[model samples]
Target: MPDTSFPGAWSVDAEGSAPPFEQLRARVLDLVTSGDLPAGFRLPPVRTLAEQLGLAANTVARAYKELEADGIVETHGRGGTLVSAQGDAARRAAQQAAAEYAAKTRSLGITEADALELARTALSLR
Candidate 1:
């Protein structure tokens, strides 16, 4: 059984090129799709996350909104947010494959851009 604890270490890079909301959204998506955060994980409240990451509550809310829109998470008023189990089997398989690819690519010291280009090339080949 996975911990399913609130993943508080998810942080924002204030100086990075990506907008804070986008960064937060991506981190949440990665956590869900990586299986580090299993289905049914409860996310920290928007205000709490904002305080932890030094972002505005609205920023975190926006990220949460995006995650909900993408079906990675579902929010219940007063009950908080939870990782969705809607695509459990498919998501688990995809995450496992992604983990394998990431492990292999990291062993070769591939940068994100290189990995993305590699994926793009592979997609084109298909």
Candidate 2:
């Protein structure tokens, strides 16, 4: 079995502005990006982590699904989920988002220079 104990305590703030599943997803993503959960680190099974964190299995499952969709984690049949290589995963996710943004801007008839400027402004805000 994969280790149930992650590097730090994990909790879902039921009263927080974000939903529980999103909070969990963000926490796991933060861990991956921060190098606390290294590449190839297997995460606990959904039910097991759900029990530990007092969340519904579905909630944990949704978080894992979103993480996998974002390329931050890979799910193996019966082998469990493992963190992806941070640098590569982050780059791929960013590229995909940029592509989607570009498509949307084009569909909206935004000029290339305007789109580029909007992107630059968003990056600057970050």
Among these predictions, the greatest lDDT belongs to: 2
| Tens-digit lDDT track of model 1 for 1-126 | 334344555567888878999988878877787777777788888898888789999999999998887678889987888888862544666688889988899899999789989978975651
Model 2 clash count equals: 0
15: Cα error in model 1, Å: 1.1
Flag clash pairs in model 2: none
For all candidates, the clash counts are: 0, 0
Clashing pairs in 1: none
Q: Flag regions of model 2 displaced more than 4 Å.
A: 91-126
The lDDT per prediction is: 0.79, 0.85
Model 1 misplaced regions, further than 4 Å: 1-8, 87-126
lDDT tens readout by residue for model 2, 94-113: 78999999999999999999
Q: State how far residue 109 of model 2 sits from its true place (Å).
A: 18
For TM-score, the strongest prediction is 2
